[model samples]
Structure formats: structure tokens, C-alpha cells
Target: MTEVLQDLAEYIEQKRSDCVISWGFTNGELNISVAPSNITSFVEFLRSDSRCKFSTLVDITGVDYPDRTKRFDVVYHLLSMYQNHRIRLKVSIRESEAIHSIVSVHPSANWFEREVFDMFGILFRDHPDLRRILTDYGFQGFPLRKDFPTTGYNEVRYDEVQKKVVYEPVSLTQEYRQFDFMSPWEGAEYIISDDEAEGSKLMDGSKGFKDTLTSEQKIRNFNINFGPQHPAAHGVLRLVLELDGEIVERCDPHIGLLHRGTEKLMESRTYLQNLPYFDRLDYVAPMNQEHAWCLAIEKLTKVNVPRRASLIRVLYSEIGRILNHLLNVTTQAMDVGALTPPLWGFEEREKLMVFYERACGARLHAAYFRPGGVHQDLPDDLLKDIANWAEEFPAVLQDIDELLTENRIFKQRNVDIGIVSEDDIQKFGFSGVMVRGSGLAWDLRRAQPYECYDEFDFKVPIGKNGDCYDRYLVRMEEMRQSLSIIKQAIQKLLDEPGDILARGKITPPKRAEMKGSMEALIHHFKLYTEGFHVPEGEIYACVEAPKGEFGVYLVSDGSNKPYRAKLRAPGYLHLQAMDHMASGHQLADVAAIIGTMDIVFGEIDR
Candidate 1:
């Protein structure tokens, strides 16, 4: 991988001019500094150059350095599916400076640039619609900035006399409290360290609807909001649809209703304290999020996880993947009027949640993943439960397939409904099912092979067409593969058992060791207080999450807490492709498209 990246870097240097300011490797990944002036050309070069076809725009975010003259570092993460490599480009800019938007190069950049603008107040030039994408409609100040207050400036409450909710200046009954570094939840346990609208052209160069319509016959489309409420909208997602009667002329996804400032909170918390927060991102697949974060921290601190811990992490990650896909498929069915799948599917989900409870205390927010490994070892019976479920899940999948995959009703609603092409997949930075459903064999677990995924023998399932039905099929097949991986890992764990947590500065001292040894006690106390210091640097680590490639970008200032934390939530990126897929389709197909993507609003809004 490093060799491929190095070759690509050399090629980029030869082809491009002053666009690349500097290039280096950190945490086994490539990092390049590009000039803000030439970012558009540089990005285009990366996407078009054969030697460096970094066609996918993975993420666009900014990190704040209030003291620096250039207060913000606008970062773009790119991936080359052709070369199978990833790169990070950094361009320093002041808060007042506006950088060129890569939306024309990669249409997925629309919302991402909007998110950066919303969070850091960084401006983007030529971005079609650059408004606050994640914050409240009229919210003031950038919450992600270091100087922003955690409590914020205002609060909303229902006004009894006015009969509506109203925003008012924040009034506190209790003042903001100072930390004494005593709370266990807030402390760092000594872990080892660790768009749119091609309206009339059909976007495929097909005949335009307007070309056929006469002057009086031309339909005028009106915009109507779909959600920000319950029902079919999925979460707080509001789709402002420009409709030509029932058919959707355009669809614009309005997210951020559930934004919780997750990245900002991560910066303020200790490394150990931040693990639980990752769980909240993709609440459905919490373990994978925590796993990615742990990988980044472990890379930063240079900690090697034990084989046993790796196997356990792999097992739980697969389980989380299965759990996530099950809910996705079932709810997808439910969204399209098939109700029985979720009833049967969630039964299996509940059983898996029991396994989660047995492994860690919490079922949903299982912050089980730690810097070096997981919080604790799995119970002896947990593998048995997994094995039993592995045997049982095939029948469950078959039942679901019988009910939805082949049923004429399911096929009618899903088949050829929301078709996405290979070019669109790469342009939108899709991963997991989105690419797989489009018949691309691009599973990060196989391509990048983090944790013990390389050791497991499982296949990456793919679909022939990028339609709604194909996406559903890919997810169903992926769950079976996940089960296969889980069984293999379980067998390996049974054959060779070892310490789950790696022995390092990050892992806390054993209770018995602490009671007997003064050094052990001191290590525990110090780890719980000041925590472990990480070498000053940056790393972007990702895992093949259920929805897509969930990544964590961490910058350490040689402190216990991360200096900057940016999460690349795949759901957020997938949502950007909504308008692309939904145009010219019926408005009712919007729910099917969203459900097929299996987006968790927690991650999207974050």
C-alpha cells in the first residue's frame, strides 16, 4: 500500500506544479499539502490522472487553530478506486478566505463543503448552495471552533402564551462547572494510546422532458417539504421536493436536524471518554465506529493489539454489520409497505443485542472497543451463542428473501426504481453496499484489511445493477458473509485464547495487579487522571462499516485529548446522492431510495 502511495505521489509531483506544497507519510498513510489557490485544478488532476485517479471525494472538513494566522486548515480526503490508495490534502486558510469548491469535480462535495461552512464558517467559492447544513436555521457562531462555549448561546422552549416554541438567550440555573479531573467517564483511562439536478436532460444525455413539452403544456413544478417529522422521512430528514404533480422533478435533502456536534465534543473529551460518543454516530453499528477510532488512536500511540483482541474485534464488527443490515433491510421493507420482515428480523436483532450485553454491559452503546483492544474479553458462552445464531440466521434470511426479494409486490416497488451508475458511485464517495450494489467489488475490509479481517475467509458480495432491489440484495448477501466471518473468528478464538486487551500504557492495570503492586496502582491513578500522551501527528483510520467506509481523522497535539477529531460518516455522503438518484422518479420512490441507502440520521446530522 505504501509503495502504491509513494509511486502515486511521485507521479503527482511530476504531473502537477506548485499545487502540491509538500507530501509526506504519517501513520502509514499519505498526506499532501496543496495550495488553496490551485485546489480546483489539483483535485481535477487527481481525479483525471491515470497514475493517480483519486476519483472519490471521501470527505471535506476543517480543523481550527485559533492562534494561527490561517485559523483553519481545510482538509479533503480522496480515494482512488483504480489505484486502491487514499490521500489527504490540506490547505491552510484564514476564516475570511474562501477556497474553491470541488463540487464540479465531484458532485458529492456540495453538502460536505456546506458542512465545513456550517461548522467552521469557512467559505467556499462556486458552491451552488452553501448554507448552514448541520446547524439550526439561524444559529450563530461555529460550534466546532475551539473557542465556542459547550453550552452554547441560546436555548429553546415552548412559550405557553404564544402557543409555539421560541428561542431565547440562554439562562442557567447553575453556572458552568469546572472539571476536577475526577469523573471516571470524563477521564482518559490509560489505554495504550492509542445533488442535484440535472433537471431536463435526464442527466444521462437522454431526451429532455422539456424538449417535448409545448409552451402551455410545460408543467411548473412546486417545492414541497417531505419531512423533518416521523413517518416516511426516516429521521429528521426534510426533503424539499420540486414536484411535477406526483413525479419528482428534483429532490433536495435537508439534514442536520439531529446534529449533536459530535466532533466538537470529541475534541473536548479525553481519548477514552470519546469512545462512547462514536457509538452515537451510527447508533445501529456503534462497534464499527468505536473500532475505527480505536485503530486511529492505536496508530498514533504505536500499539500492537493482541491476536485474541483482534479476533474479538473482528467478530463483534461482523455482528454489528449484520445487525445494521438486518434493520436496514427490514425497515426498507417496512418503508415500502411490507411489515412482517422487521418483526421477524428484529427478533434476531434482539438476540444479537443479548450477545452485545454479554460481551459488554450496554447492548446499544457498547463502547467495548478501546485503544489497544476491546474493553474486556468476551464471555465463554458468547461464542456458543454466536455459533447458534450463525446456524439460525440462514433460515431467517431465507424467510426474508421469500417475503421480499422474490415477492411480486416487493419487486414492483423496488426494481429499476433508483438506479445509480458506476461513475456516480465513484463521484459520490460511496462504499459498502452502495458500490457493491452497483457491481463494484470494493469492500474496505478486503481492500484495506484492518483488524483481523484479512485473516478471515469471507467473500465480498456484489450486485449486477445499482437499483433499489440490487442494493437490498447486496445487503442481504452481506449479512450472510458477516455471519460466515463471525463463525470463522469464533472458531479461531476457541482454538487459541489469549488476553483480549493489549498490555500497554493505554490498557488499565488489572485489579489484582493494582492491589499487589504500588507501580500498578500508580499507573492506574495516573492513567485515570492525566491519561497517556500521544505523539503529535495525525492519522485517518477507517473501517468497512455497514453503511459504508466510516473513518476517523485524529490530530494529536501531544495531549490526552485529540486536538482535532473529524468523522467521515458514510451516511452523510450517501445522502448527497439523493437528488441524483431521485430525479424523474415518483416522489414515493424517495423513501425507497433512502431506505435502500440504510442511512442513520445520527451519523448524517452529526
Candidate 2:
């Protein structure tokens, strides 16, 4: 590990243009934090440096540390294409300040950076076009910051003259937003330096002619806004594309349309309470989100999940993967104007939702996994039903494949569209099918096995041509692989008939037991009130989520609540790939490319 860190340090040192602040090998992986000012330079170094040819930007996100001197931290996770290694780089800046953008270096950073700016108020310097990504325009204050009010910083009123809604500033003096801003670092007294204040004025110049272009002219020449609500934009994502007619000169993705300040909310809630929020992060695959968070908490607490529970987790996660991929394939086809397949896909997904309800009592927001184990054991009949579905899915899959996969029209629309090369994949740090489609055989389940994934026999599918067609094929193959794993897990579940809950107090007593037994009642009351404590440290647990490697980096301060919780959603990374994939393609093909990427806005915005 020291050797690896030293090598990484040397590589960073050699790439002098890239600002490398501090780096070390932690949790069996190399982690580095760089300044955002050198984001483009750092990305170039990662792409060119032989020892650190980190071809892919796996994740880009922003963390709000309102109390800290550096108010926001923009984090980038990179994967080495040659070494099969991963490293994290973080660049922190004041919440009100703009850091250098990485869009030019890695097109995928466009959306991710915008998301940071939108939610946390961490500006990206030199961003082609930066606007509100998630929240409605004219929305006041960054919602993700600890100091920001939750009820909201602005009040909307109808504009009679403008024929649209308008925002008026709400008083920060009254804490109406459910946020407690008692920290010394918070409040309106915090003013920018004179130079920065001047810079802000210049950037926001009212007389600037550069901002006067008509909407049609903007799309025709350089600047293009794809969607605040475009059919292909997967969940209200808006992209400001700087195009040179048929070729994209530069693209900046504006995200945050779904921002709810989830991380901030997580900080206020107990570890267990945060589980439900994870379900909303990647609404398409709640099981994977739940599993990732649980795994992170488990690592921090050193909780022992039962063998049966592990098997159950694996089974549910695989089912979630299959469900997510099905949605991706069906939706991609639908976005490209092929509507029949989505209906067929939704039918299959509806059946999976039924299984989800039976397993966890909720369809999409199934808060199934607990820190130590699952919320409840799978019923015998439910397991049997899942097994039956797994058995029958292949035939349905074949039927869908026959109808859509080989259809000439579908191929014509998707075959060469949205092509992302291996180098582009690495530069963007993408994963799951996006990276795999580019011929990089990288899957978290295979590379860094979690749960009982090491015991399972499965193939990590890769595609030769990283295009829409390859992505479609990869998703289909992955569904089949998910089924195989599900079958194997079902067999294991049948063989292992033991307690699903761990031999500890992590789980609350059942309602019936609590009503009957005094001891059980006490345990339940204590569990609910105090919550379980975890050891002081941090753990980053990643799972191969449907979109990519979804990771949860959780920090526990020996409290019932997590000190900090960070979600590394793959959709955010995949969304970044859009600028690269959509560039050079006609404006009409953008929708098809966006659909093929399979991004969920909930994940991206969060």
C-alpha cells in the first residue's frame, strides 16, 4: 500500500500543472485530494500519466461544509485504465466562490460540476454556460449548504406582467427553512473579499452583449440548452450545449432539478433513519441504494450480517439490477421513438415491483436493508415466486430481444449513435455499462466484491464498440447474468434455513414479541429512542448499481447519526458522458444518446 501511494505521489509530483494537495492509501485504495483550480490539469494528468492513466471519472460530486473555512468540496473519483486502480480527488472552495471547471478536460464533468454549483453554490470557473440545473430558476440560496434554510430561501408569487412565476427573497433572520444556522461560520455577515466581490460583479455584468443571443441563434451557433424538460433528458436534466453546428464545441450540463438536500437531511437523522432517503437517491433501483448505505454503516460499526441475510441482500440486489437494466433498455428504445419495447419492459418491471412489495412492504422505496441485516426475512413463498420469475424471465427476455434487439429500425437509430471511446470512458471515470460498453471489464462486484458476490459465479460483460447498440446489448446480457445469480442465491437460500437477523440488538424486537415480553418492549423502546452506535471512522462501500458503481462514503462519530454521508451515484458520471457521446452527432440524435446512457435524475441531482 505504501508503495502504491508512493507511486501515486510520484505521478502527481511529475504532473506539476495538476495541484496535488495531499494523498494516501486508505481502506486499501489510493485517495488523493486536489484543488479545483487545477481540475482540467489534473484530468489531463490522469489521462496521460503512464502510472496514473485514470481514464474514467467514476464520480463527481459536491459536499457542503458550511462551518469549514472551505465551504464546499468538489470531489472527483478516477479509475486507472491500465492498473485497475481507483483514486479519489477532492477540491474545496468557498461556497460562494467559483472553482475552475473540468468540462474541457473531461466532458462528463460538465453536469456533475453544475450539480455542485446548483445545490451547494460552489461555482465552476469557465463553465460554458452555468444555470440552475435542478431547482427552478430564480430560486434563492444553495439548498445543500448547512446554513441554507430547508423551508426554502425564496417564496414564489405569480407575475401578472411577466406571465410566469417570480421569486422574492425570504428573510434569513427568521429560521423558516427548518435549518439551524447557529455555527459561527454561518449567517449573512460572511462577506466575500473585495477582489472576489469585484470579480462576481464583472461576471454578472448587466451590459454584457455575450448574453443577448436569441434562443434559436444560441442553438444554431454555439450555446444550446437541451432540456429542463426534454423527452430524452432522463428526469428533467438540462444541458447547455455549446455547439459548432453539427459538432459540440463544448457542453455544460446543468443539473439539480431534483435536489432535496439529502446529505444535509442525512446529517440530521440517525443512521437507520437515513435508509429511506437512500431509496430516493436512485429511485430506479432502491434496493442497491439501500444495500450500499447498509454496507457502509456495517463497515463503520463492524456489524456482522448473518449468512442468510447476506444471501438475501445479494438476491434482492440482483433483482434490482435486472429491474433497472430492463427499465434502461425499454426506455432507451422509447426515447428513440420505438415505443413497443418499453411497454413490454414495464410489464416485466411491474412483476418485479410485486416481488419488491412482498419482500420489503414497499415497491420503489423498499427500506429493506438495516445496518446489521435486513428489515425482515424473505418469506418462503416470496423466495419461491422470485425463483419462478428468474426461471421464466429468460423466455420473456428472448421475446423482447427478438422484437427489439434485432429490429432493423432500432439498430439504425442506435447502432453508431452516442459513441464513447475507451479513452473518453476513462477520462470521464464512468463505470457499469458505460465503462464496460467501452471494453473496460470493470465492475465493482467483480473488482471489489461486497456481500457474498465473491462466492457467486458470474461474468462481467464487456462491449467492443462503446455505442448505443453496445450499451443496449450489455444491459441485456447483464439482465441474464442477474438472473443466473438470482437462481444461485435462491438455491443457497433453500439450503440455508437459519436466522436472518444477526445475534445482536441491532434489530428491534418484532411488534408481537414487544407486546408480549417486557424485555422485548424495553429493547424496542431503547432501540427507537437512542438508536445503535457505530465506531468512529469512515467507510466507502460501493455496489454495482444498475447505472454503475454506486458508493456510500459514510463517516460516523460514534453517534447514532452519521457525521457525514456521501452518495457516489453512477448516473451523475454517466450523465457526464453525454457531452462526449452527443458531440459531433446531429442535434436530433441527442435524445437517443441521452436515453441510451440510462441516467436517473434523482441519482444525478442527489
Candidate 2 structure quality by residue, lDDT tens digits, 280-383: 88888888898888888777666788899999999989988988889888888888778888888999999999999998789989988887888888878988
TM-score on alpha carbons, each prediction = 0.89, 0.80
Which digits, one per residue and each the tens of the lDDT, describe model 1 over residues 1-606? Answer: 788778778878878867988998987888888999999999999899877888999988899898899989998899988778889999999878989999899988998898888787888999999898887655766677776757655767799999999988665432332333443455655332112344433433353345355534344556788987957777888888988878998888888889888887877788988888988889997998899999999999999999999999899999999999999999989998998999998998999999999988889999898888888887668888789879988999998988887889889999998898899887888888999999999999998888878777888888897899999999898988888998899999989978877777998878899999999999989887877888899999899999999998899999899999888889887888888899999988988998998888888877
**10 residues in a row with least lDDT, candidate 1:** 190-199
The best candidate by TM-score is 1
RMSD each, Å:
10.2, 9.5
In model 1, state the lDDT of residue 44.
95
